[model samples]
Target: MAAAKSGGITAYSVKTKTKNVPMVDPVIDVKSGRYIATGKDADGNKMAAIMSKATAESHIEAGNAKKGSGWSK
Candidate 1:
């Protein structure tokens, strides 16, 4: 998995599931130290943005996404 990039900053997006259904769009903003989510769905509600990460073991972890993999530091 690749780190999400916005304006040259690295970040990670993780999705939480409930009963095999997506519940929220959890995003970790690296440069700003902010964890944001679009919140749960409500009646007649629409999400502005949706981002998610894979759940496989081979999938990139949130920590790795934030740190990147091409450098040693």
Candidate 2:
């Protein structure tokens, strides 16, 4: 697997109330195999967290996010 270095561009999935909501989040790359995201949660309130790459991929698999750059939605 590819290792994400610090300062890389990574997106984290923000869970929604309804099923399969397509959305994107801007996250800060953490050198320790995690991402820091700042966005509104399902309740539409401010939220942030350090998430893993697997968690991010889960979001994509769950239809919450489109494929990463260079691929189609």
Q: Each candidate: what lDDT?
A: 0.28, 0.41
In angstroms, how far off is 68's CA in candidate 2? 8.6
Worst 10 residues of 2 by lDDT: 1-10
Query: Which is the leading candidate under lDDT?
Result: 2
Query: Model 1: clashing residue pairs?
Result: none
**Which parts of model 1 are misplaced by more than 4 Å?**
1-31, 44-73
- The root-mean-square deviation over C-alpha atoms between each candidate and the true structure, in angstroms, is 11.8, 11.1
Per-residue lDDT, model 1, residue 26, is 32
Give each model a TM-score. 0.19, 0.35
Query: Stretches of candidate 2 above 4 Å error?
Result: 1-33, 65-73
Model 2 C-alpha lDDT per residue in residues 1-73, reported as the tens digit of each score: 1222232223233444332222235333344545444444345544444556675565445544434333223
Q: Give the TM-score comparing model 2 with the true structure, all chains together.
A: 0.35
Least well predicted 10-residue stretch by lDDT in candidate 1: 50-59
